[model samples]
Target: MTESLTIVRDDLTGAATRGLIAAHLAGMLANTPVESVHALDLTELQHPSVRVYSAWVGGEIAAVGAFKTFDTDRAELKSMRVADAFLGRGWGRAMLGHLEREARDAGIRSLWLETGSGPDFVAARRLYESAGFSYCPPFGDYSLDPLSVFMTRDLDPASESAGR
Candidate 1:
């Protein structure tokens, strides 16, 4: 907990970033059915609508989180993973909060995410809920499935009221 951490927007095409993403994808797939694994890969992360980030401590990657735009008012959290050694130390929470702030500043009023709904994902589910994300219908191209859980949170109270 004493190590300094830096989470910033990153390009995922780099070798190290690719390695981190591969590890993340492995975890996601291993924890859920292949059809339900919606985690993005290197090619998918290159889309113009997506922004990737990496958290660093002691000059090594600590975690990675991504922001994917859904039109102008909505964004989806993608590729959220903390290095195994960094788990349970609040890096994931910090990265999620950072991405939420980035999305809000970019004018995204709604933030959504899709994660596995299995015991392996308990910690991730807890992190999202504790950060104010709540269960919601499947988003984007996703459909309801017992293996997947979708959650969302309104980023701006003012916008939520304005829409009403």
Candidate 2:
């Protein structure tokens, strides 16, 4: 099947975007405990530094991702999810690349993220690893927990070509 991908700064005030995120978070939190997904609701997704992106395929939302800036040179990946039908079809990779590019454009030199250390999150960990992230100590409000894992990748301008 042919799919078109576009990444844009999302405005959560829109009902469609809110519905998409709500459904994604609800699904993620359904099987896993609330603490596992740790996803932000619509209100929290509106933080000043968070830039959300939605991937649309033929006018339907295919996936979603966000970059939450923590400082001038650092940011965190949050709320990344691909619709069930689109998983494993390279949508996740495309979204990650888009977020990385957005971070670079914003002058961020590093990106970090936290994911659950459960079977449900294994694929996500592998995805981040394949995208150049390496295991790292927890950052921001996170602390080491048996149920959590943290990863980070440096976004050096000189290494941009090699990364791609």
Cα displacement (angstroms), candidate 2, residue 139, comes to 1.0
lDDT (Cα atoms) of all candidates against the true structure: 0.86, 0.83
lDDT at 149 for candidate 2?
A: 87
**Which lDDT tens digits does candidate 1 get at residues 1-164?**
68899887897756767889999999877777788889998989989999999999977899999989989999999999998888888888888878877888889988999888888889999988887789999888999899999999888734322111
Instruction: Name the candidate that leads on TM-score.
Output: 1
Give all TM-scores, in the order shown: 0.92, 0.90
Model 1 misplaced stretches (Cα beyond 4 Å)? 157-164
TM-score of 1: 0.92
Candidate 2 on 1-164: residue-level lDDT in tens? Answer: 36677767888776656777988788777757766666777777888888898888876777889988999999999889888777878888888888888899899999999888888788999999888899999889887778788999998765552244
Residue 92, model 1: lDDT of 87
| Pairs of colliding residues, candidate 1 | none
